[model samples]
Target: MSERLNGIEAFVAAVEAGNFALAAQRLGLTRSAVGKSVARLEARLGTRLFHRTTRSQSLTEDGQAYYERCRRALAELDAADAALEAGRLTPSGRLRITMPEVLGRVLVAPLLLELGAQYPELSFDAAFNDRRVDLVEEGLDLAIRSGPLDDSTALAARPMGHQWMGMFASPAYLAARGRPASLEALLAQASAHRFVGYVRDSGRPPWQFRDAKGQAVAFTPSSQFDFGCNSLEIAAMAAMQGAGIARLPVWLVREALDQGRLVRVFEEPQAFGYAVHAVWPHARAMPLKTRVLIDLLVERLVPALAVR
Candidate 1:
């Protein structure tokens, strides 16, 4: 266990320093020792973490994946030690955060409000928007992201939870254009029904489903509406207005579902190949306030977004 921990510590130090020599300086070891430790870790995992030659070095695919997890884990460990040493009950800091508009307002804001009451010294500078701001450029401290973080090399993220996308429409719309009894029916009469497109960084995401065996299938919405949106609540509103069928998070439409304003089609849970994450810049070690907030978010978000 100590050996593995040493290897991980060496690996993270090297990655953060962007080279073994600087990592050696930071870790108080020889460059050769740091390199050897990383190599040992790679051999144990049976996967190469880096591609290094005399002139160039870069993280391998496996390395990139592992590095993200390791960096966050190390930050949490460092933060726990700092918090214990600080020996303070009330956290005091101004946290700058960003999140999607609807989620920020509907789900996250309430939690923050409750947390504020817990630690009155803690304050927030938040931006609720669909636009993905550069956290570093904006000097943001934390962000709750709901999709792939392909461009997150400078960020350390922890999976908080995920929301399921299910097909739903206003009761009136379903009544007018008979309910899609199954996935096949939904696709077959494609021209008869319109769909609200979900715009993402990769472009408009298609409806995703899982077969009986739980293999994923992506179905592009052929018939469309006048609007495409990035906001869950807005897309749901379009469906509620009978503009089209929307594939949206169930939480956004739970009230509508209960009130019979909307009805879910095809009794199954589906995904758009993504999950939610709470992220902060990699350069900063987690502070006591940030750590507590992340803990609260994970504790609350998972159950709130759980598929029923």
Candidate 2:
């Protein structure tokens, strides 16, 4: 039975490593030895754990179920070890996070480095992509999201702040075209101005602004241009280059506005506003490291993005 525990561990390592040779190397045992350990475990369980071919090896259905249980058990063991260590020292573990690339590069990277300096025991595994990911399935500690989050029973979210959408263009563009004095004037000059637009989910061409009173305002774009990007940072860049009026988050274009490279248009009617949030899985007992990271984000991010 004591040998059986070793066999179980070997079997799990083999399944996770996706190959017997790799698993053997990881476990610091010969390939033949790993095979024997797996065979012993399979014999005891009365089932084959893997389906192997010349090119590949994959877990059987039973093996997958068993692996899930074993993985959770191993995770719990590691968590207990960390918990004991945490009491004696600062939180120490790898915290995996995901966020948008532009925001991550512009904002998160510096903050995370500072955090690392503060807590030398903590480390980060951060990836930046615009695509939505399943936090639990992907084993993510946290994700930064910009917009309304769908209702999910499995996750909890903390609102960072709200972002207001506004239109901006380079000073050069405004000087060339002569800035429109009113919304109606802006709409009239739309045909001569290069207009940057977003492809909405509903297949509508681009977004039109409506006032708080719900009055639809149309800006007849001079020339319609679509770069087919979902990132506001990219669109704002186009606007800075004098491409045309771009509807983007005010937060993203603040630096340009301060430098006089870009000027806000349509100050009277605010377009759409979206909320930014930090989302994480709702676990029974959230890890101390994750809690600490989330707190740091909430404290730092809110002030950094405070409405000017």
For lDDT, the strongest prediction is 1
Candidate 2 residue runs with Cα over 4 Å from true position: 1-89, 182-184, 197-205, 208-210, 214-231
Error of 2 at 292 (Å): 1.9
State the lDDT of candidate 1 residue by residue for 1-308, as single tens digits: 65676688889998889899998666645577778889889999999999999976889999999999998987898887777757867778899999988878898999899889999999998888877778878889989888766433345677777776788988888889889887888889878887886786657766778876788888887644456877777888888898878888877788899998889876764353357888786533467678888888888877788754
lDDT of each: 0.79, 0.74
In model 1, which regions exceed 4 Å deviation?
A: 1-87, 151-154, 200-203, 226-230, 269-273, 283-285
lDDT of 2: 0.74
Model 1 has an lDDT value of: 0.79
Number of the top candidate by TM-score? 1
Number of colliding residue pairs in model 1: 0
Question: Per-candidate TM vs. native?
Answer: 0.70, 0.64
Summed backbone clashes in each candidate are 0, 5
Residues forming the 10-long window of minimal summed lDDT in candidate 2: 219-228
Q: After aligning candidate 1 to the native by TM-score, how far in Å is the CA of 44 from where it should be?
A: 22
